[model samples]
Target: MTGRRRWTTDEILGTAAELLRTSDAESFSVRKLAAALGTDSSSLYRHFRNKTELLRAVADRTLEAAMDGYRPPDGWKERLTATALRLREAFGQHPQVAAIWGRYGSGGPGSRLVMEEVLQALRASGLPDEEIPARYHRVVILVTALIASEAGVGALLPEEYEQGMEQFRVAVLGADPDRFPALSHFAREIRPLGVDRRAAFDEIIAAHLAQIEIAIP
Candidate 1:
């Protein structure tokens, strides 16, 4: 009988992160991870209680990478936007990871560290103390939604996605221009564009920052 290979916690976590980068949660399984590692499926339980816990570990590692080399910005709005952009880039690298972490604000060490940075920036800003919590909540919700949207679309490769857009255009492009002028005009501009998650993220961040400005008291 063959013996099971010993795996280090760090190695397990690293592999889990890679698995998330290449695979979505829908198809990623502990058995698949074990196969990838050339180990028994049950052995992963030594490092993680279950799939959720393992993926949470992966998400936490991603947070560290996301904020790596990060420095405090000159002003609070700059701070928020800078952090937001880094997080978006991180998601771009591992789109599936976004959905996992977004569902749970479970506050692993890396998550707590990032949140502290945000709070530090908010404190330095002149926004009223009473309004800080609500503002923070809104920022979290908006950023998470944007990341999730990006991740969902990323289930396919870029060329595969572009093909999907072409197929959709074929389905709907036959609409009479006079009857649906708005759809005809806008579909041409937007459909080929596909999911510009970063652009959508920037627009909402600007709107939210505007709200932050109004909250200053």
Candidate 2:
């Protein structure tokens, strides 16, 4: 008979993420993960203190994936934009991990690595050293909040999810033209302006960049 297989942390996290993708988040358990890995919960516990830690680690792993192959651009604005866009894509690609990150709002080594890269870009933006900490917080909040707002739908049932989006469309696009002139204007122009998420993401990033640009020395 074959002996038991030993799993590396990467292998474990990868399988954990896959299980998160397929299973209900609330009901997902270590036993299920162990079963998927052909091992016991004890083995997983050795690597992670508990389920929450494991989930956080998985969240970091997701961030690691987002940073993979990303090269910081020459200009600070370009670097920030590219990083934000990469993160948005990663959230879309790994909705489960994104949901966990949104809830936890913290990270491990993987998150630290991404933070370091972002800080480097922020420093390159020529902001005062005294302001870097606050600005760094702002960048992290803006990027993650936007991505999480869209990623929250990942856990929803298909029908319910569509209903929520439909509600947004009806509420915004169907608002009174007189009362909400700006929204009405946007609604009218939205079609040619590209109403897809990429458009919204670009606008938000642009606004963020503009704010940073104004603050630069």
Candidate 3:
């Protein structure tokens, strides 16, 4: 008879992530994951203490996946931008992971790597020693807030989102030129780009970098 198959920690986390992609977090459980793996919950408990631990590991694994091919760039700005953009892409790719990650700020190795890189880049910015902490956190908050906004919209149903966008486009396009000169003037352009999270991310990051550039001197 064949012996029971053994599973590695990485394999378990990978499977969990795959399951989460299609399943809602509210319904995910160790039993479900075990069932998916064709094993039992007892087998999974050997690797993780509990369901929460397993989810945290899965979230951390997602972070590592985001920085899989990352290499520090030459300049501080470049390094920071690269790391931040990778995170944005990862969050977009794995919205479920992003949800869990936002819940548990569990400082795993992947989280450490991101924080360390950001701190290092901030150090290279020549900000005052005491101000670095505030700035570092500000950067984190800005990215998290903007990405979360995008993710929230993504969680809405397709028809619901399209309907909302249609309402917004109508409101913008129908505005009077005299009362709302700027909105009327840019209404056509805004209709296409108004709900564009990717463009918003790029623009916000560019503005933040510009602020950093100004403070560098």
TM-score, each model? 0.87, 0.84, 0.81
Clashes of 2: 0
lDDT, candidate 1, 1-217, per-residue tens: 9777799977887887788777777788999889889998788897889988888888888788888899987999889999889988887788788888887544677788788888888877898788878888888788888877777777578888878877888756766778988777776565443456567778889888988888787
* Candidate number of the best TM-score: 1
Residue 46 shift from truth in candidate 1, angstroms: 2.0
The C-alpha local distance difference test score for the whole of candidate 3 amounts to 0.81
Worst window of 10 by summed lDDT in candidate 1: 188-197
Candidate 2 lowest-lDDT run of ten = 188-197
**lDDT measured at residue 56 in model 2 versus the true structure, 0 to 100:** 86
**Tens digit per residue, CA lDDT, model 2, 1-217:** 9988889999999998888776655777899999999899998898999888888888888888888887888998888889888888887877777877878855677798779988998889899989888988888888887787767665566887678768778888899989998988888455422137677888898898789889988
- Which segments of candidate 1 are over 4 A away from where they belong? 1-5, 191-196
Task: Look at candidate 3 and tell me the lDDT of residue 196.
Answer: 65
TM-score quality measure for candidate 3: 0.81
lDDT of 3 by residue, 8-113 (tens): 9998998998888776578899999999899999999999999888888887887787788889998888888888888878877767777777776556888888
Clash pairs, model 3 backbone: none
lDDT of the candidates, in the order given: 0.81, 0.82, 0.81
